[model samples]
Target: MRAQSSATGRTAKAVTPPHAPSSARPAGRGAGTGAGTALALSGVFCFSLTFPSTVWGLESFGPWSLVALRGVLAAAVAGAFLLMWRVPLPDRRHWAGLAVVGGGVVIGFPLLTTLALGTSSTAHAAVVVGLLPLTTALFAALRTGRRPSRPFWAAAVAGAAVVAAFTWQQSGGALSVGDLYLFGALLVCAAGYTEGGRLASRMPGWQVVGWALVLCLPVTVAGSAVALALEPVHWSAHGAVGLAWVAAGSTFLGLYVWYRGMAGIGVARASQLQLAQPLMTLAWSYGLLGEELTWAAPLAAAGVLICIAVTQRACD
Candidate 1:
């Protein structure tokens, strides 16, 4: 769970903003592992809330509009925080990394999730999104040249099978195209989380996220402008409420907490904590969307939890 080292005994190259410090090799392993696990659990809870809030927000706004507006608002909020704290701006080197991270997390992931949920049930989305840990682990291995143990891969494969079975049962044996897109979204978000974790360790969690959003403001604004130009947008009371909740709670607050957790923890252990998200999403979907929880729900939940436990033990 500690920051990974490359094969050459160097720090693994992280796709972080220029102002962010390079990954640090922990001086003591025990303390670092414990801190990482705690932070990762917090990140899991924050991420679990995203899907339910997205379902609420999408009741009114178009997917593109919802994502674009969320990014713009999130960036503004982050900017205000920076000004108040007098945090120094990131230098040019960090800007490129911020741009990539922001585009992946702020623009791409939200947009994809919103679009997929337009056609698929939130429960379906949850099951598919559970693969994020596997994706993050793959990215970590590729980036750090650290090979995971065989049991880790076995658990991941078993977890995917459980999710696949759940999805098939929920859909009555037919897979929706939206399911594929949602899985793609999970992969992209996983990469962002992994890269973001590396940067978070170097800067204050809020600063890392705030500055990245600020750096990506121009792109967000441009995207929002295009959506507005093409659509006759009317903000209803419900839409306004939804947007307010998503902007304040999901985008701003959720991301702040997630980055804080990542800053304290490394990416691999943090990814393990994401196993909780599918369960939370399933609960919210059943309550709010009136979705029926099939027998698959309990079975899939058990399997995913077991896989996470196995992976955690392997890491230990």
Candidate 2:
């Protein structure tokens, strides 16, 4: 969706109509499409642990403080990468896109999810994130102008419905504010994913994220410092470790590949693979958070996978 242009003075605008036909795309993306998909899946797997890790971190760190710390840590890593690689500064056109990516992923989604998971169960948060792929695809469609087939929408909606129903049942047939937080997380995360995907098509995946993080570094550093000072933390080793892992994996490396995959395969197809994330979260809950996996978890996983597979097979 993104191609480098000689003109670089304006806020980034879609170069082509977002609803253009797939046949309109150029062919250079083919060489790395498969690799990108693999990388995206790997990113997803790494991200699956984020919820459980957040739950752990919340045991010692305040939600805002934890968020700030994670962002700062992640910014450090991203800054190092950009410096080591001597990544060229983004031009004005690309700067707008990078800002969108930074706002969505680097700042918005992390802050929201951290706050949400402070009160919500890791397992529940994971299941809720299952909504992400559909939302991500939606943003991709809007931005790139390629549409999913009707059947794709159907399966996607059904899968979301299944998750919603299960969540309602689990919560005693009532929804709560946490669901709202998760939904908010979904929106911002999808926006980030969409913008990053667009940018990834024109640059190296790692550099895209590194630059975004570097772009946000100033705010992230100040925010974390203020949060830590304003609210005292319990400061456990477990929380520190959890925070570090999320900073390194979820905040940086995972996004590096995720954007690449979305750029390579088209967001709709690439995103369907995120159906596995909730199940992976469930596993992490059991193993790391010591939550018992219920029979319903496996059933839900199977159902979501089937729906995603159906969605993936649809012809646009």
- The prediction achieving the highest TM-score against the true structure is 2
Candidate 2: C-alpha RMSD after superposition: 6.4
Candidate 2 yields a Cα-based lDDT of 0.78
In candidate 1, position 207 carries an lDDT of 63
Per residue, candidate 2 scores C-alpha lDDT tens digits across 1-316 of: 4433346544443343355323123322664666656777888888998888888788788888888788888889978766654445565578888888888888888888888776677887888788888898899899889888889989888888878777787778877778778889899888888888877777666767878888888898888888888877887888888898889988887887677666777677878889889988888898888887667766776678788678767833
- Weakest 10 consecutive residues of candidate 2 by summed lDDT: 19-28
Q: How does candidate 1 fare on TM-score?
A: 0.83
Among all candidates shown, the one with the greatest lDDT:
2
TM-score of each: 0.83, 0.88
Q: Give candidate 2 misplaced runs (Cα > 4 Å).
A: 1-32
